[model samples]
Every structure is written in structure tokens, then in C-alpha cells.
Target: MSSAFDDFELKGHKLDNRFVVAPMTRTSADSKGKPTELMGDYYARFAEGGWPLIISEGVYTDRQASQGYVNQPGITDAPQTDAWKQVVERVHKHGAKFIMQLMHAGAQFQHNEYTDTPIAPSEVKPKGEPLALYGESDGWKPPKAMDESDFDAVMQGFVGSVNRAEEAGFDGVELHAANGYLLNEFLSEHFNQRGDQWGGDIGHRLKFVAMVAKACKDAAKGENFIVGIRLGQITVTDPDYQWPEGEDAMIKIVKALKEAGIDYIHTTDTDVSRKPFKGGSNKTLAEIVQEFSDIPLIVNGGIDESNYEHIAAHYPNALLALGKKALANPDMPKRLKDGETIEDLEFAMLQPTATLENEWQWRDEHDKHIEAD
Candidate 1:
């Protein structure tokens, strides 16, 4: 009998299972943006622990301009590419596939790092002030309005990252168009006020994103490469905000992504299980996405043992991506396979290193002692 554990094909590869490690930022790389030994070991454990596919943390594609936080990895240069090779090799050794998430933080990043002002679809400030956890709060500023020249450069940067990811041995790439980053900024009405070809209605707003997706897809042609995109309902900067045109715009965006040849659409939002606010369908967000696209929709956020079964039932090809839960337990799927209950973890336990609470706390005290000595 076929089970939920049965293999499913995604982007030319038969994924070993529907369980995926959702992309989460770990700001632990060097300033120059090289992945550390710890980073490789960190990801390989999830693969070794049995996840079929892993979406890596958001990796900046435009070197300086795209960086959102300090110590996060970059994919714009040879060193960054070379560093990722170690990660790919380790994941492949465990029989799991890896995909790099290409991102540009846009106005949500540091202005000091780039010296030049950060570029966005339009000049607008983010909704809230930045957080200290991201290393610098002042990084969140109104971005300079992007011109035709900046658009050309940004497009090339995304396409370059895809080429570099393939060269670095990754099986695929996912564009981070969600979470109020550059792409998400364009999708929001409060941010993108441009009246040009790149902005206006739902379709026009998605034009630049489509360009990047198509360029990356074209670059990966004939290669054993998978190209996908991630979408979000609300911006990280403004949770209360809705899309400029609401559900219709969202439905249109999904269709546009599918037409651009994206193999899958990974959605990060309020919750996959939440009911529609003002839609004709009584179905949840996951069902709505499935309704709009023929491809797989990776539903994330608020997915745990409690609701995963019900949420997964909405889409025939839904991939359940675990974020905080995955950080706490690499063997999440194994537990599910054995029918074990998921843990309720403290937020402090899932960052920097997802180790035991006492161990992490002890290490901090030890470091202070060493400093005094």
C-alpha cells in the first residue's frame, strides 16, 4: 500500500519524501559571506536525519545590495560558491537533494554595508523599525527608487546566482520573493508605487519577478536543475497589511509563477490552514494555491503534527515544510513515521545552534569565564 512516505517527483527528481526542511536564516557566516564548517554540518544533519529535500537559508544574490543581515551567506562570488560545494557534497552523500534560496533583502538591509543606497521597486519605508536580532536595526530604511539600470543589474544578479548554484553542485534554486524582501516589497501597495511597466496592477507588479524567474529557468535549461519560487501573503515588516488587491491578486500571482516555468510554489504566510478572508471558496490558503496552480505548493507556517494531516489533505501534491520544528528535531519525519508527538520547544533553543537548553546556556557562561581569564 502506498503511504504519505511514498516518493513524489519534483522538478525532474523523484523526491524521497514530502517532508522538507524549510529555509531559515542562520546569521553565522563570515563577513565576507563564506559558509562555515558549522553551516555544512548543520544542514547535513537534516539530510542524514532523513529529509528528502532541503531548502537552504536565504542566500544573497547581489553581493552587497542584497544582504539583509550580517554573517548570512552570499552566492555572488567564487568563495561563496566554493563554500556551498561542501554542503552539497554532504547532503548528496546522505541521498538527499538541496536547493539554494536566492534572495535580495532590498530596503530591509544595511545601507552602510553597500555604501550605495539599497534599491527597491519604489522608494518607501518599511512598516516597522528593524530588530536587534538581525544585527542592526538601522538597516531598515527607505530604499532608493530603482531605475532601469538597477533593474538590469538586479535581474543579472538573480540569474548569476542560479548559474553559480548549479556550478556549486546544488540540485536546484528557489527565489525568495516573500517575507517583505525586494520581491515582496514590489508586491505590496504601501511599498511599490511605481507607475511604469514594473508596477500598477497585480500582473504588472509581478513582471520583474517573472523576468528573474524566466531568466533563471532559461539558464538552467537542459541541466539537472530545478527552479522554484516562494510566495507570502503578508510582509514581515507589516503583518496587518494585505496585498494591494487581496485574494484575486494573490491567485493571479500564483498563475504567473506557474507560467514562468516554476516547478513549485512554496508559500510562507499567516498560516496555511487559515480560512479565506473574503473569497468565494471556503477552502484554506493551501487549497487556494492548489486551486490556482497545477504544480506542487509547499505549505509552511503553523504546520505541526496537530494540523499537518488536515492541511496536507487539501493538496494532492503538498509538501510539508518544517521550520522551527525541524531546527529542534532533525528526525521529525522519523517521529512521524513512528507516530511520536512533536515537541513544544522554546524559541531560545532553535537559534544559532539548535542544541539542548542547558548546554547552550552553559556555553555562554563558559565563554564569559574565558573572557575574564
Candidate 2:
């Protein structure tokens, strides 16, 4: 049996505990796509709070259509890559490993500096309107169908970003293939309607993601450089969507990712324990992954102080990645270990927009209001 406080190892990186800070999009970077000083502090806060591993928010990989929101961080140019060094340095000082999550917006796009159009496996729009938390948009725009050149560019973007991540001194890179982003758009049958080899069946749909993963692994400058991916059937806005192929499809997807040299798999959903298989399977997505592969597992979604112990007991070998709970308490690991009362996350902290500066300002005002009473 494994507890959350126990040390764990993923690839060659030895984690201090099974607790991880999940990647969250704060949309808190400079207008030029450089990581700001504030962003460094925002990430370092988690490491200082006792999280062993911190996965950064989705970072655009290319200057062409990869950016999904205004002020989103990018890793395309030298200066942007150089700016990330400070962020990595800050986290490393706390003895925590940081992994940059590389993403392409696809049709879920709200804004992009390089191009007005989003690119995807097909010219499909996302099922729901763009998220108000990230950016404002009436609805999702239909993406341009990707061609051979587009495919090459997407691959190059991921590989180049992985190299930049190495240059920035990151421990690893997680391909943002979940949450209906570009890679995930390819995975979703609703978004990926292409009749070509890149679409149709589970294997074909997974081909692009596999190729990107292999390219990232091959491009890693260090043998110990970790390359992982976040996978989910549901997007941020569209929750009801599941694979038409269901549990078997998920099994094959896990098998394919393992074959593609993915170092680990992070399964996220609205709830990690939910049986979302439309075919009526009793297993959760994380369980399916555990049953199929021996790779390191990081499970996310609705993992909070109340249910963490039970969740940990079930996925004994897996790392529990916390998003909302971590936002509520950056020092969750320390607090949990100390048996301190952890506060719940209030939506007011992210009111109007989700940004590091905004959160700080909100806290100041909130604390002041409390004192005034």
C-alpha cells in the first residue's frame, strides 16, 4: 500500500511525494509571449508549498496558431525560451521538478498572434463556446484542415518546444493532448472528421499524437528527459462527449501511447472515479490505463482533501494531481501532512479573468473587506 506522503519515482526523477501540482491555464504571461516575473512566482509558490512536481499551464509551441488566449506564454523564439529559465530556476530552488505543458489551441481558439485561423485534423468547430475564464468569444471558430505541411509544422513545433524546454532547464515536457486542444482535437471524433489516414479509427486518430510523442522523445537532449501526455475524453466545455469506441478504444489508445514512447500518462476527467465508458464498463479511465500499461500514472480531476485518501488507496502507485484543491491551498501537501484545515477554492479568486496579478489583487481586497467587518 502507498500513501500520498510516500516518495515516488517517475522515469528517472525521484519525487518527494505522490502529490503533484496539476497544470492550469492562468493566461498570465506578457503580451509578447514571454514568461513574466510574476509567472515565475506563481509557479514557485507551489513548489515552495511542498509539491514535488509542478506541471505548468499550456504553453503554445509555435508562433503559428498555437496560442489560444491573449497573453499566453510561448516557446517559439530565443527570448521566450530564455525568459522561462527564471521560472525553472525558481521552482528548482524549492527542490521541485517542473514540466512544461506544450499545447496547440486548434478550433478551441479564441485568439492567436500569428494567425487568425486555427488548424485541426478537420475543419470542425468545437462543440461549445470558448471558455470565459481564458478569453472572451461568442463561439469557437472552425479550424482549417491540416495538410502535409501543417502536419510537419505541428511536429516541428512540439519538437522545437521540447528542445526549448530543455534549454530552459525543465525536467520534462507534457504534450497537451487533452482538454480538446490541438492534439486532443485530433483524438475527438467530433472535432476530427477527416476521412484520411489521420482519422477514421482509434489507431488512425491516435497516429498524429503518437508521431508527436515519438518526435518529442527523439528530440529530448537528455536520456533522462521525461516526455509525458495528458489524455481525456472530455474537454473543458464539453463534458458529455465520450469515445464512440468506449473502453476498448481507451485500452487501445493507452497501448498506442505506450508504444509511442510516452514516459507517463496523466488521465483527467470531471471525476477520476467516474465510469464514463458509454459502453457501460465499470472501470474508470485511470483504472483502464493501470490495467493496460506499466507506465507511471498521474491521475487528476476532483481530487481534494476529503477524497484524496480514498483515491490514493485505490491507485496505490499513482500520483494524485490536484488542480482546484491546489488553487485553494498552494501548501496543500504541507497542510495535509500537518493535518491543518485546507480552505476551499472560491470562484471569486478567478473572477473576470484568471491571472496571477488578478488573483493577488483579489486576495488583497478580500482580506481587507474581511478585516473591515
Candidate 3:
């Protein structure tokens, strides 16, 4: 079977390898919402270590309420764009393609922290209480339902972000549509109770995504910028948020995305091996998306070296996106391609601080060992 190191052409870009570094929030940016030198060093290390495609952490759009976490990177203004330009240049120099995952936190915001009320398609509260960044403990508050004006503003915000991303020298942009964010909120009937064109049934529910896609395409003009969407089987807030409409809703959405001219579709599941649809079948979401979409498809979640061969054998054209695995072993793609076993590859720890702490500790220990030598 072809390994993760196999080179493939995705959206006209010749990716050196099929293993993509999935976007994981580091919250390592400075207070100005610009990436810091340390953050740049961290991502550059991964690129240098051999990940072919590195999808940067979720970057907040222009909306103030879109700031999901403290110290999360933003691509809102000129300085942020300049900072991202540096990041893109570094990653490209290291022979890796960088895509900015543009995201709006939507109603998933902690009202106590950023704004008094988070705006969503509907005035629906998310499942659980919101946690503050790190040690802060202010709880959750119900979000405000977005009116027509708010919706228009959000669309404009996304468009502005896309323009900024292109200006920042990113190779492409991935719309963060998954994880119970704004797009997902619109998709879920529970969250989206609007009677307008932006809500209601599946067709209307998908309008937000369609609008965003069109806006992004318009902002980029005719640039060959890759536009991808990251969609999940279930959202974080609603683990039980399965649709009674089954794969039909998902199929319809994929068809719509394909029609929208998106370059690729990135599907996420709790486990890559698990089916993305509500049914507990072995048919993965990538397979289903491929059936519906004419564009390329990338699959992420619970991917490791052990399952690489199996996945490759089964899904030939599918690109595997590795999150925790990439974090733990930056050279994992090379290792897998070399036919080396990666059962012992370190698993990534949860939360940004923990990841930073572990990386720092390991660096210190390695430095001391080098000194001893």
C-alpha cells in the first residue's frame, strides 16, 4: 500500500507528502493577536521536521466576538497579516504549504470574557458551561440570536478575513465550519431555529456555508488559492447531535460545497476509523464525501501510524490529516513512508498550555543531554 509519504497533487499544488498537519489551537500568540516568535519557531520546527502541509491553528476573523480563546491568533488587521506573512514564509521555506484556518467562534464564546452576548444564527445556548482560558472560571451565558443585520455583518467579517489571509501570503484558507462553531450552529437544527433563509431545513441551513464560500471566492478574485472546509461528524457541545435525516443532509451539503467550487473537503471524526455519519457503519465520511463531492477529500481524527497502512489500502486517494500524532512526532510522515513502525510515537497532550509545557520540558532535557555529551 502507498504510505503517508506518497506525494500527491491537491488543488493544483504538488504536496510533497499526503500527511497533513491538522490545525490544533496553541493559543501561543501575543496579546495583539499576532503570532509570536516562539509560535513561529514552534510551527517552523514541524515544517522542518517533515510535515508537508501544515494547517495553522484557527485564526479569528474580524469580529470581536469571534475571539474564542485568549491569545489565539487572529488575521484581522494589518499587523496580524504581516505576522502571518512571516509564518507563511517560514513554513514555505521549510518546504511546507501553510493554510490559514479562518474561524469565527460564534456563540461558543464565554460572554464574561470577550463580549456580553455572543451572536449565533439563533439565540440558542450551547450544551455545557463555557470554560475560561487556563485558570479563569467565569461560567456560561446564553448567546444572542443573530438578526439579519448581524448575519450580514458576519458574512462581511468572513470576507474581510479571507482578503487578509490572502494578503498574509497564506497558500490557501480553510473555513472552520465544524466543532459547533458558527457554521455548525447553522447546520444543526437544534441551534438554528431561525425562520429566515439562513435557517430552517437543510437547504436553508446550508446557506451560511454557501455564502461564506462565495464571499471567500470573491475576495480572493481568481487566485488559485485552495479553499477547504473542515466538517465534523458531531460537534463538541452536542455529542448526541445526530440527525434523523441521516446521511441525506450530509450528502446534500457535500453536493452544495462541490457546486460552490470549494477546492477540497476536510472531514473530521472522533476516530478516523469510525463512520462520520450517524449510522455506526464502517463507511468513513471521506468515502461518503468522495461519493458526493467531485473535489479532493482529506480525513482527520484518531489517525496513527498503526492504521496508516489500512487507511491507505482502503482509501487510496484520500489524504490523511494527523493532529496529535503530528504534534508528537513532526517527522511522522517520513517515518511512516520509510516503513518504520511508529507505535511508540508520543501522543499529544490536551490543551495548549500542556503542549507548550511538554515541548519546553523536552527541549530543556535535550539541551542538558547535549551539554553532558
lDDT of each: 0.77, 0.89, 0.75
Worst lDDT run of 10 residues, candidate 2, spans: 364-373
By lDDT, the better pick of 2 and 3 is: 2
Q: Candidate 3: which stretches are off by over 4 Å?
A: 111-114, 131-135, 279-282, 338-358, 362-373
Across 196-309, the per-residue lDDT of candidate 3 in tens digits comes to 888778888988897788778768753578888898647766756765556877888888888788888898878777765566645666777877666787888787867866
Q: Give the per-residue lDDT digits (tens) of candidate 1, residues 1-373.
A: 3334768788678877788999978776777888887677778878877789999998988754788777778898999899999888988898889999998988887533454567788888787777554555544566799987888788888988998999999999999988888988888777789999888987888888887888889988445689988887567767666665667877888778778888888887677766543444455556667787787778888777777766666566878888878866666787788877766545654343433333246446545111100
Candidate 1 regions exceeding 4 Å error are 1-3, 276-283, 350-373
* TM-score for each of the candidates: 0.90, 0.97, 0.90
- Locate the minimum summed-lDDT window of 10 residues in model 1: 364-373
Clashes per model (N, Cα, C within 3 A): 0, 0, 0
Give the CA lDDT, 0 to 100, for residue 177 in model 1. Answer: 88
RMSD of each predicted structure: 4.4, 2.7, 3.2
Q: Model 2 clash pairs?
A: none
Clashing pairs in 1: none
Q: Model 2, residue 184: what's the lDDT?
A: 91
